[model samples]
Target: MAIYSSTSPKFFLSSASTSTTSTTAMSTTKKLKRYLELDSSLEDEIPSKKKQQLPRRTCLVCDVEKGTNQFPNHKKVSSHEHDHNVCDPCYRSHLENEIDSKGWNEVACPECSITLTYKEVKNMTTAENFAKYEQACIRATLAADPDFRYCLSTTCKSGQLHPGGTDEPIFRCEHCGHKHCIVCEANWHQDQTCEEFQAVRRRLHAENERSQQEVKKLSKPCPGCRVPIQKNRGCDHMRCSRCRHEFCWVCSADHGLIFREGNHRHEKNCIHYRANPRAQEPELPRHRIERMLEPDTRLRAYNRGDLDDSDFDGSDSDDSDLDDTEPWDDEADLPLVYEPDLILSEVRRRAPGQTLSRVYVG
Candidate 1:
């Protein structure tokens, strides 16, 4: 026999490790099996039980569908109490006072394929039940009536279950050509999977796309002036000050009144002045007068240094004759008029009618 040491540390350690691993593996396996069983049992039992317990529904006003074990049980009338299964709500609905109101007609429940009169639905035993029955009848009738329905989407046509847990809807508006999901009564487009509320959304989108394409295809010049034509690129409206043109973004045609004409003159003036400073000049002097009548005599009279009173002696007859016969070339054209004295007395003696020429002459 091989020599075996009972107290060897290596053997003891190996044994302990194997035991721990085996225990762990066994526990893990057991936990896994338990989980599998739980999953299978839930799948098999719970859903089936749920389905069995779910309420069976039948239209109260019509003979459409009848589901069992549903809540909101209806009681039969006293006349038909023996028949507990009878839908009393449906029976009482046949005697409404408004049967004649608005030409009440007999409408069939589309869901149950049973004819239900409006008078029957309106005559529910209780007000609350009557309202409920009436609503159900309306839904059924609307679903069956082609006039009230639109077309079904492909998804609905293919019978895809709605996310809402109810029976799928089958009714749609005939005019709009829209279909509502059976479960949620939610409408969806034929091409898309998402639920939509408005039927016009797709149409509106197409119209908008068409409009954008038309706008893009159009090639008109800037309405403000005959420049480049980039429609709706920046602004819709433009104002041209050069030609006073006003127009939409596309057209380059001469559109007047975009800018006012009155200010062009001022603007031109300003520009001209800015470019050529000399364009703006001041006015000429306005006060100079011509001294043409008296010439040298007036000049000599005004010039104090030229002559004195000796030139005009009052009593000198010889000087007087000389003055009258003077050979003055400058005064030759002037009339012969003279005074002997050249002082204030002479001016005082002159008549009021005497002008500057006459006064100086005298």
Candidate 2:
């Protein structure tokens, strides 16, 4: 048996494998170098082909290289370092968005933050957008102007371009044929000056306020027509002239409770009737009260033969002259005299069985 050392065989095998790997690597490297040298020689032998170039541009917005024609009439921003170009569509869109969001006053380029001139913006945007920008500018200018006035016509709200320091009170609308006073903001008053018109307006306002206060104080809506009824001085047995609906003034019910019949007889369940039983008593006939209070009126009624103590029913009297819907305004002309004792004595004397409990004089 030949005793061969294990270490020697292993070392020899390792050396052989290393040599093979080195040879393969050297061959691959040489082939690569030769290919490169061949490519360089070919380049040197043949004239370099002219490279074809296409007209191109870079869009600042999208950051894409597009054909130069794609940016026709495009916006450009020139700085010290470089010039920035934006495509037509992108530039128009940016202008429209800026005009819409920031309005005409603050419209600016999104890229360069440069404020665009009105002419530049108008040329870039659409017709509709340009019109909107123009209108916005007009509105802003008018708002800042102290002399600016809008037409008072509902059909046409066109602005009136009144020059500053013009003392013209009347302005005629060019859009609609309506003339109005600028100071009062009302229809033109040919008879009155601006000061007079304003004074009349103030007086009308005061009268309206006074009327409203009177309505709230002395008026109640009718149950049938819902029209406000003001009782200046009348019987509790109220009749709505508009709807012809009869009701008690004290109870506000459709019950037949004459004011002359006494307040307790009106409606026991009514809040007002229960609250003031004596105060809500039936009123005396207007004619009789007038006769008893005013001797001159009584003599006039007697001369006309319209006054009869026995058959003097208020319903029979001609109330055609008086409007039931309106309160009696002539109360100021009449004397404020309350002779309850005299009225009750007269009532007792006229009708023995018809006893008078209370009398309310307004």
Give me the candidate number with maximum TM-score.
2
Q: In model 2, what is the error at residue 128, expressed in angstroms?
A: 3.9
Mind giving the per-residue lDDT tens digits that candidate 2 earns over 127-189?
888898999898888868877778888888687676643377778877887888776778898
lDDT of 1 by residue, 1-362 (tens): 12457687342346667788899999999999999999999899988998887765655446555545321233312222122232444544433333323222444322232444444344334676456556655555665643343346653322222332333345544445556654344564465444453446668889999987876577554544555444445654555555455654433323243232222223333321122112233221111011123344534543544445655433222223222133333334334333223222333333235444433342
Model 2, TM vs. native: 0.32
**Structural similarity to truth (TM-score) of each candidate:** 0.17, 0.32
In candidate 2, stretches whose alpha carbon ends up further than 4 angstroms from where it belongs are: 1-65, 72-82, 101-103, 134-149, 157-166, 185-362
Worst 10 residues of 1 by lDDT: 283-292
User: Per-model C-alpha lDDT, please?
Assistant: 0.44, 0.67
